[model samples]
Target chain A: MARWEPNARERLVRAAIDLFAEQGYDATTVTGIAERAGLTKTTFFRHFPDKREVLFAGQELHSRTLAEAVAAAPAQATPLEAVAAALDALAATFTEDRRDFAARLLAVIAANDELRERAAFKHDQLAAAIAGALRERGTPGPAAGLAAELGVRAFDDAFARWSDPSVARTLTDLAREALDELRAALAALG
Target chain B: MARWEPNARERLVRAAIDLFAEQGYDATTVTGIAERAGLTKTTFFRHFPDKREVLFAGQELHSRTLAEAVAAAPAQATPLEAVAAALDALAATFTEDRRDFAARLLAVIAANDELRERAAFKHDQLAAAIAGALRERGTPGPAAGLAAELGVRAFDDAFARWSDPSVARTLTDLAREALDELRAALAALG
Candidate 1:
């Protein structure tokens, strides 16, 4: 039987990110990540399937968080309102302590084509999750999808801004502001 | 010196799609695709970087077509109007002759995770190209991005509908209708 490791996942992620940043993502290996975290390769495999997946650690949990929040919105709430609530829930997961890590993660992803592609897939998945939740709440197809897209765009834009060390606003506040900007921009599309 | 092969790209694409549909994507290989196409592996490499890229053959040309159309829209055209023109231009490339191919291509992509990720990346790239062109034409940041996303969504939805053998409408018409429906859905978002 394998011994239980404390915060093994978190430690592995930090180690992977540090290694990726130092030696470049392509040069980093699973064994190196495991060794850096003081864990066995088996422990690393238990948490992540590969080095690339380590960077996308919370994808499933984030998707669930967004969907559950959208599902829990008031029955009478508009699609956009539900999306707003979902963004709040997602943003809450990115507390102040993770801001620097978020910035570094963004830089690493931006530097690599495979990582960028994976990021785009994750973005689409998140939007789809929000859209599915809205549809379950009786929102029509197009509107559900559009509202979900807006929510994701807002969260993504706000995340980029929040990752900047100079930005003092909370992720939730930035997301709300970005969503409002997009809502206002819709009228100007004409 | 290598002998030139006529329609090598097209032949390779058709062969890949057929092979992927027959034996499944994972079971297929570049050498197998080249052999089925009656071309050499070197010729296949000349056209596509890998087997997966064979399915996304016209990606660069499609992006260029969309961006150029958006850039060439009338000076007074609204952002959405520019996107509509871009969609029409893009749809023209997918004539009736290509409908069956498009359907097969979509099915092959739908069955594979790696291909789906590539598709999402391509989708984002197309949207970004349109957004960049819109920005060049004086459209603001948020509105340009929102309009570009709507255009991509409309075209994607229209392509799916047009892929059905029973759908008689032209790709252009379906895209226009889809865009109009999304525009109307915007009003119901709140």
Candidate 2:
């Protein structure tokens, strides 16, 4: 249904970002975004609740993609391995297409307290979602919770590394290294 | 300089929490908290910049205490264990006198987004402090960062479990358990 909406929800998001970037978030109005996308306020309202929703446009997709990635991991993969794969899947899903927007959105969210809190909440939700998926795969108790959270935390660290142009490693490489670091630190306890 | 404030910060915090629980946070004012503590408004303002200061009152001290705990860890201990010991130290500090008020503060911070964000930021600061302490103890590079963060994260997870009334485990036990879970997950991939 959304596919044939011409300038659909995603298109509105792209137009919104462009407008927001060009004129700053607060200065850019929904009407201007819709107009730029050749979309209407009704269509925009049909797609999103408000302007801030544009910043979170990729979150649901990111969460779903991560869930699917965890679900698809090899049966023999360790919990962290499964998590790493899930993060990799998310990186793949974003591709080059969403990289700019993802980074921008992250920066905007980082700078805004309310948005940062929302990001933290959503990250917890994703961690819970992954933990549940791991439970279905025979993972247990706090181990599952730790694995899920470690994955998200590692993702955060690795993504921070990967997103920086000065960062020398690929996203998957960074993910692998990040998990390796998690391993080494955990092992140091023994 | 802050020491000559009369009733002291701790007294003020206790009084504030009591009044907040009795009359609610929004309904309670600094004057009321100070008056309840039998201190003047000047004394209250001397100890705290404002009313919200009491709620987040322990952040600096908490970080310092944890840092000291990590630094005091024995050389034979693994990074994770040492970090765990630091957390144990902090727990012991809590159990000594003010655990109930601490628990109430945690609950209050957990319920409010602004407070939670501040809490999260403080955690980040604590983790960074731990990382610096690790480096001082001769841990290096990303290893130090990872170890410090792992310790902090593990401590956080363990504390959450330990503080739960339904969870019967001690913080050390939970920390060990979390490390075991982390070790198993990481070893599977290693």
lDDT of 1 by residue, B101-165 (tens): 88999999999988999999999999999999999999999999999999999999999999998
Off by over 4 Å in 1: A1-3, B1-3
In candidate 2, residue A151 scores what lDDT? 77
Give candidate 2's error at residue A127 in angstroms. 2.6
For A1-190, candidate 2 gives per-residue lDDT tens digits of 5665875887898888787677777788989988998878888999888887876776678778877888899999877878888988876654555556756666766766656656666666678878888888898756677678667777777777776766656676777777777666555533
TM-score (C-alpha) between model 2 and the true structure: 0.73
Report the CAPRI category for model 1: medium
Q: Pick the TM-score winner.
A: 1
- Among all candidates shown, the one with the greatest lDDT: 1
Docking class of 2: acceptable
Clashes by residue pair, model 1: none
Candidate 2 docks with a DockQ of 0.24
